[model samples]
Structure formats: C-alpha cells, structure tokens
Target: MEKNDFLCPHCRGHLRPNNKIILSARTPDNKVGLILLSPELGEYSVVKHDSFKIKEGEHIDIFCPVCHADLGTYHENKNLAKIIMIDEKGIESDIVFSEIAGQKSTCKIHGDQIEDFGEDASIYTNLWGATPKY
Candidate 1:
C-alpha cells in the first residue's frame, strides 16, 4: 500500500510502514539480527548482514492503525511480525492481518491495537525479497 493509504483509523495519524522491523536474537547469546520477510509473499526471505545497533532503554515508534495513535516503544526482540510468507512453489503471499508477536498498546482514537500490517510494509517486503529480474 502507498503511504497515503496509511492513516490511523482513530486519530487519523499518518503512519509510514517501515520495511525494516528490527530484532535482537534471544538465544545463542545476545546478538542483533534482521529477518527480511516478504510482506507480499508472506514468508521469510533473507537475514541481514549488519547487526542492529540499538541503545539500552530505547523505545521505537509503533503506530496504531485504527486511530493513528503512536504506540510507545518496545524491546527490539519482542517486536516480531510475520509480515510475509512463501509457499512451496516460491510464490510470495502478503498477510494483511498477521499477528504481531509483541504489540503492547491500544489505539488512541479507536481504543484498539493496530492489527493490520499496512500496505507499505507489504510492498516494501515484496520489493526487498523480490528477484533481481522481476
């Protein structure tokens, strides 16, 4: 989805779907990692090379879809979303309302959490995971 389509349903706040959903590895020692999931294909794509550099006690910005409210920050590793997935045939599928693992707030306008992974996330994930020729 385009950026214009991203309006908080509650406060109507604008949300930019960030292609990079940062994560920190829990097991095998504390290390940062990036899992590029194709939002369009709905599957894991590739792992990033660089480790995510985050400061302690830092909160990232999470937007609410229903009300456009700014849900406060969360731990890096706790924010996991199955934004994309892939089938056996290598066809990509976008999951619009996939469950996000670490969402911990409600929307200001609608008083609900943002459940839908917006179109920007979908398109970004697809482009990131797409083959070079495509």
Candidate 2:
C-alpha cells in the first residue's frame, strides 16, 4: 500500500501506513471489531464490537472512503483471537512458514491427500477477476 493512497474520511488528511490492520471477534456476543494503526499519522482507529461475521481461512478487503484506496487485506484466525494478516499479496510478497512446534507433520496448501477427509477442503477460483478489488 502506498503512503498517499489512503485519506481520512473525517479530516481528509493522508492516511499513513502502519503496514498492519487487526480484526477481532469478541466472545459470547461474537461481535467483530477492527483496529487500524497508522505509523505515519502516529494514530490509531479502533472500531469496537461491530456486527461483522467472518470465517477462518477467508480473505478480507479493506478500503478507505476519502481516497478510495485499497487499504489492505486481512485474514481471520482460529478462535476469538485477534485476527492477523498471515499473507500480504501486492505490497509485500514472501513465503510464510508455519510450525506446529514439536508436532511431526507436513501440511501443504495444495498437495497429495493422505486420507479422504471428505468435504473438509475445497478449492475456490475467481474467474474474470471476480476476486476482491483490494
């Protein structure tokens, strides 16, 4: 994401790049919230306990209203833990490794299937740029 791409909706000022955005879902109520930190502006925007439903392994597209910039992407993790961006596509591209920490197993994104594990996994394709704009 570029530095001048985003602008604050309320102030119409440049939205700085902190390079990260976090999503969290509270327990019991299961309300989703967003926390955006901008290093350039040295400020943080917290949207608490909103009604947004998201699932694990899914991609989220964030945008700015003032400048209409594709801010970034986010991924929802397991449980009610604060969601983190596991993989960033355009701005930064790098291979990510995950370790089970002492567990002996090799998991791949698209690889051979050891067991049937029917209906547990499926592949999704976005034809004609049906993917999210961000």
Candidate 3:
C-alpha cells in the first residue's frame, strides 16, 4: 500500500481504489447507499446516489465494502470511524475521521504523535488527550 491507501481496521482490507475510498453507508432512517470518498485527507468531497440523501448534521454508519465491518468507533468515539492507513514507507497508523455528514474532522495517530486536519478536528482531539503535532 502507498501513503494514502485506507484499510478496514477490522479486516485489513483495502478501502481505497483508484483514488477513492469506497464505503457502504446507511442513513439514520435506514437508507442505504454507496459513498465514494476522496482518499486524500481533509478532502470532504463525496459522490453518492441522489436517492440517498443525508443532512448536514446527520450521523452516517460507514462500513467496509469488502468485509462489511461497521467502521464506527462506538466505544472510543461515536462520531468517528476508524481505519488503517499504510504509508508509502509501509508504516501503518490509525486513521479516525468524523462520520457526521458535513463535519470535516480527520486524525492520523502513530504511536504518541497525532496529526489533525479539518475545521471540526478539535471536536475529538480532547478525547485522545494529546495535542496534535504539525
């Protein structure tokens, strides 16, 4: 895997394909959809079917398309989903990001270092109790 390849934390399956992260998503009302997320961190652009409508503050349940694993970190942070990121050098890190629609928050945690991105990132930094390093 390269620097931006995302993986399912539970099954270690590749989540990104051809520069996009493919995930199975469900709305609160049980509306199912396929979401295409940008692989680049901090890019909030999404591509989904018009039938699957999500509100700004709506909480989405993201899953791994390959293993069907629920990616939400319910025990740790309910608003976020966890994934594994394998960098170009083959180092893996835990990547957590907001699952809330319209909320842009992403973090990369490797050992004791934390790197945060997006405006809403601060909403969960305190949950880890560690300051984000540049």
Candidate 4:
C-alpha cells in the first residue's frame, strides 16, 4: 500500500487498490466504465477499457466504485470531483480534481491550507477563497 490512500468521501471506502485509484465513471452519453487513475496526485495518466471512449474537453461524471456515490456533487463546483486522502499517519485531507477530460488540475486541502497542482490548478484557486495570482 502507498503512503497515501484515496477514498470515497461518502462511503469512506478504500479507492486505491493495486496502486491505482479505481473510480466508476459515466460519459455524457450514459456509457459507464471503470477508470483507473494514478494514485499520485497531478499524474494525469489514465487506464480504462478501450470501449469507454472519452473525448478531450468532454465532461465525465465520477463516482465511488464501492458505494456508487457521485463524487462530483461533494464539491461546490460541479466541474470538479472530491475524494478523501488519508496519509500513513492517519491525517485526512480533501483531494479535489477536475472532472473534465484532459483538464489538468488538482488541489489538496487540509484545514485552511490549500496546495494546488498541475498547470490548470490556478483556474479553480479562487473557488476556495484563495487569492488569485496575477
């Protein structure tokens, strides 16, 4: 197991299995598939069956594979999905990332502190009440 583990905010079910964060996803057309995301934050590499075709810039809905809860609804922004991250020490944090295909943005929030990652992270910085950079 990695030092950090991803989980469903609703069910608190372990999402990281086999070194990958497995999520249930649905395309706009109502196609469902299992999406395997890298456990490392900011790593955009994705693994899924070829039949689950997703176009860049398209919107995808993410869910907890264990409980079937809509992860995206947990966040105020519909464009993002939220998950729970627990470190080896048992400290928990909120991990938010874009649900838009090909969009590179992720944020780790622990208490009042927010750590942004990826080039597109700045786009949602203000959503968390963080001062936007010029």
Candidate 5:
C-alpha cells in the first residue's frame, strides 16, 4: 500500500496520521483537537473539538500549531472538510469532502481535478485533471 503523508504548507512539518487516518491538531484556544480522514476512496473527515467556540454542525477552523497555518475547515454537520495540500516539489492542491449525494471527495490543482472519489458515484484513482461533480 502506498503511504500518504500530509504536511504543513508553511513548515513542511509532517501532519502524521494516527492509526491510519486520524490527524491531531491544537485548537486556537490551546486545546487538543482532532480530525479523522477515512481511507475509503470518497472518505470524509470527521472532526472533534471541545474548546473552540463553534456551534454544533458548524465549520471549525483547524490550524497547525507549529506554524500557525490554516490547515482547513471541518464541519461535522455535513461531514465536510476542506484542506490545501502542498506536494514535495512545492506544488499545491485542494482537497475537499462532501457527504451529500453520498460521500464524495476530490483533489484538485488550480481548479483542475487531480483525484476524484465517490461512494455512490464513479470512483477514479490515479487521476489528474477534470473535476468530478457529485
């Protein structure tokens, strides 16, 4: 199995995943926070927070404590997460999750689709270009 590691866009600090998918973070309020990215093709990110002042089912901003970079926003209501990923060569891309119409996710570069995955939709692996619509 190919290993995928998420890194901080600012410091390149490896955002190591725990037990295959859970990524830990420190909330802006200085409390431990968490997000879990499922291994499924169209997996969604599950976020759990306590200290942050977020209403239930609202999007919460997650930041990297090391560099204070905006990692992404997570919302448990829709089971959605949006993250900006930077590749090893300094290339950047967008990753988003949507649970509507079945769980779906996509990785895009400059509006061009890179990887598209869906639960009740066509699943494409090793993709590059062409965004997938849920």
Candidate 6:
C-alpha cells in the first residue's frame, strides 16, 4: 500500500510499489504477470496484463525500480529473498522468506526481530507475481 513507503537501503530512494513483477532466468525467455497485493487498498489487485512475468525455473533478483538497488533474490523454488522491508513506523529491516520457515524478518535499524504480519509484513509479501514477492 502507499501507507508504507519503501526506501532503498543503499541510496534511500523511495521504492515505489511495483504492480509488475518480472522474472528472468539464466535463459532469455521470461514469465510475466500483473497480479499484486495493494497495501494501499488492503487487498489483491491486478496492475497490467503484460507485466509481472516470472520464469518457470529461474532464481530471481528483485530490485528497486527507482535506484536499481538489488533488493532481494529468491532461489529456484526456495521462496526466499534477502530484501529490505520498511514498516509503517519507518523502521527498516532485512527480510528473508522460506517455504519451511515462513518468514524471518529482522529490523536493520535496531537489529531487532520483526513481526511477520500487518503493515510490516506487506513489504515482504507484495511483489507483483514474482513467486514469493517479499
């Protein structure tokens, strides 16, 4: 949602919510989708039909569209990305998602453990359609 603003860890540039998720594999061919979670509206929404693509068997590196910082990347079928998450309180954290463990998110500001739901969780979960969008 627009309620939580995502800032780049390296440059502090505002990371806008991307309705499109693009997945690129080692090969050139990629898969795309437009579905996403709108923290603004607090529900699921479809952005565009032509974007948010995902490769079937490729590891993905999610990046900031503004500053182009490497946010996080998930391994093939791992469902985890080492991305930064900013909460409604403006606290920043590193979020790692996993199929077995659900999500392990830690605040970069205080190096404290972060909760896994509510406004804070949106940062790690709403990545267009790129698998585990966190």
Best by lDDT: 4
Q: List the RMSD of every prediction in angstroms.
A: 14.2, 13.5, 1.6, 2.2, 7.5, 9.1
1-134, model 3: which lDDT tens digit per residue? 44567889888888887778899999999999999988788888999998889999999999889999899954466888988888888888988989899999999899989999899998998888789888
lDDT of 6 by residue, 105-131 (tens): 222223533334333445444343333
Superposition error at 69 for model 4 (Å): 0.4
Off by over 4 Å in 4: 131-134
User: Can you give the lDDT of residue 101 in candidate 1?
Assistant: 28
lDDT string, candidate 4, 68-109, tens digits: 999999767899999999998889999999999999999999
| Number of backbone collisions per candidate | 17, 0, 0, 0, 0, 10
- Which residue pairs overlap in candidate 4's backbone? none
Inter-residue clash pairs, candidate 5: none
lDDT of each: 0.32, 0.27, 0.88, 0.91, 0.48, 0.40
TM-score for each candidate, following the candidate numbering: 0.24, 0.24, 0.94, 0.94, 0.46, 0.43
Off by over 4 Å in 2: 1-13, 16-35, 38-48, 72-134
TM value for model 2: 0.24
Task: List runs of model 3 lying over 4 Å from the truth.
Answer: 1-3
Tell how far residue 6 is off in model 3, in angstroms.
1.2
Candidate 3 or 6, higher lDDT?
3
What's model 4's lDDT at 115? 88
> What lDDT, from 0 to 1, does candidate 4 have?
0.91
